[model samples]
Target chain A: NAGVTQTPKFRVLKTGQSMTLLCAQDMNHEYMYWYRQDPGMGLRLIHYSVGEGTTAKGEVPDGYNVSRLKKQNFLLGLESAAPSQTSVYFCASSPRGGVGQPQHFGDGTRLSIL
Target chain B: GESVGLHLPTLSVQEGDNSIINCAYSNSASDYFIWYKQESGKGPQFIIDIRSNMDKRQGQRVTVLLNKTVKHLSLQIAATQPGDSAVYFCAENGASGGSNYKLTFGKGTLLTVNP
Candidate 1:
């Protein structure tokens, strides 16, 4: 299984440019998340989806939007990229919700806004 | 806002020595905590987890200790190896409805195991 896979391992955008990062999980997990990792700052949640057709805001959802049109896919979009948004983005997925289920993560997408 | 923080930003240990990383969380309502290790240019990988009901949980050579009374958590690796070198993060699950199960991560501790 692919577990979790994120597209565009690297990207560079100018301020005000827009782009979308795609995350796909073959595990059929119910929970999927988007996080941004900045230097000296831990991974901050950007957005999340409990299941297909359901999306919710996370800790750092500003400057981003998400969609879960399909159970296996979660998309994070930057309407207008900013330098502050330049960071490594990670996608993760967890099986059915319980305290024991561990989250599996994708490699990551390194984004740089110029 | 919920916050999780690590006691140190970096740690160095000999290959055969035991390593311990400490974390402090501000959210008392957080019932679940997790430890993740992230290698360079990669995402965090789950190591171990503990619930508020339990004080300790062990997995392989890794152990997680939770002290709810003090809102502190720790990850211990016995007989650390060079492969253990990575950035470790401690995360706590919030209590809010929508974001209750969501994880809030600490800055992370860079563990460098010397051979």
Candidate 2:
């Protein structure tokens, strides 16, 4: 199985540019999440989706938006990228169970804004 | 603001030695904790997890101990090897709200095993 996969492994954007990151999972998980990993800052949640057609803002959702139109895919969009938004983005998924279940993660997408 | 944090930012061990990584959390209501290992250019991989009701849990070569009273968590690697070199993170769930799906992750501890 492919598990979780993220596209556009690396990208460079100018200030105010827009882009989208794609995450796909074959595990058929019921929950998906978007997180950004910054140096010495751990992973901060950007957005999440509990099920298809449902999305919720996470800890740091000011510059991002997410959509879970399909059960297997979650999309993260940066409407106007900023230098502060440059970070490695990770995607994760878990089974229907609550916090007890472990999450599976994708390699991640590295984005740099100048 | 309450957050999960690691006691040390880096650790180095000799081959065949035991390695211990420590974490501290301020949220008293956290009921579930997890340890993740991340290699260079990769995502965090689940190592093991323990619930607040339990004090300790063990996997193949790793053990996780949780001390809720002190708000402390630890991950112990039995045998340090080159493959064990990576950044280790601790995450907590059930911190706030009725949602149990959200987790607070620590900054991470880098473990290096030298031959």
Please list the residue runs of candidate 2 whose C-alpha ends up more than 4 Å from where it truly belongs after superposition.
B1-8
Q: What TM-score is obtained for chain B in each of the predicted models?
A: 0.92, 0.92
Best by TM-score: 2
Runs in model 1 with CA error above 4 Å? B1-3, B6-8
- Taking all chains together, each candidate's TM-score versus the true structure is 0.93, 0.95
The residue-by-residue lDDT of candidate 2 on B1-115, one tens digit each, is 1236533388889999999998889888888899999999999999999988899999999999888888888999998899999999988886477687798888888899999
Model 1 steric clash pairs: none
Inter-residue clash pairs, candidate 2: none
In terms of DockQ, which candidate is strongest? 2
lDDT score of residue A100 within candidate 2: 81
Per-residue error (Å), model 1, residue B64: 1.1
- Please write out the lDDT profile of model 1 over residues A1-114, one tens digit for every residue: 778999999999999999999999999899999998888777888888889999988888899999999999999999999999999999999995547767789999999999
Q: Fraction of native Cα contacts kept in each candidate? A: 0.55, 0.59
Docking class of 1: medium
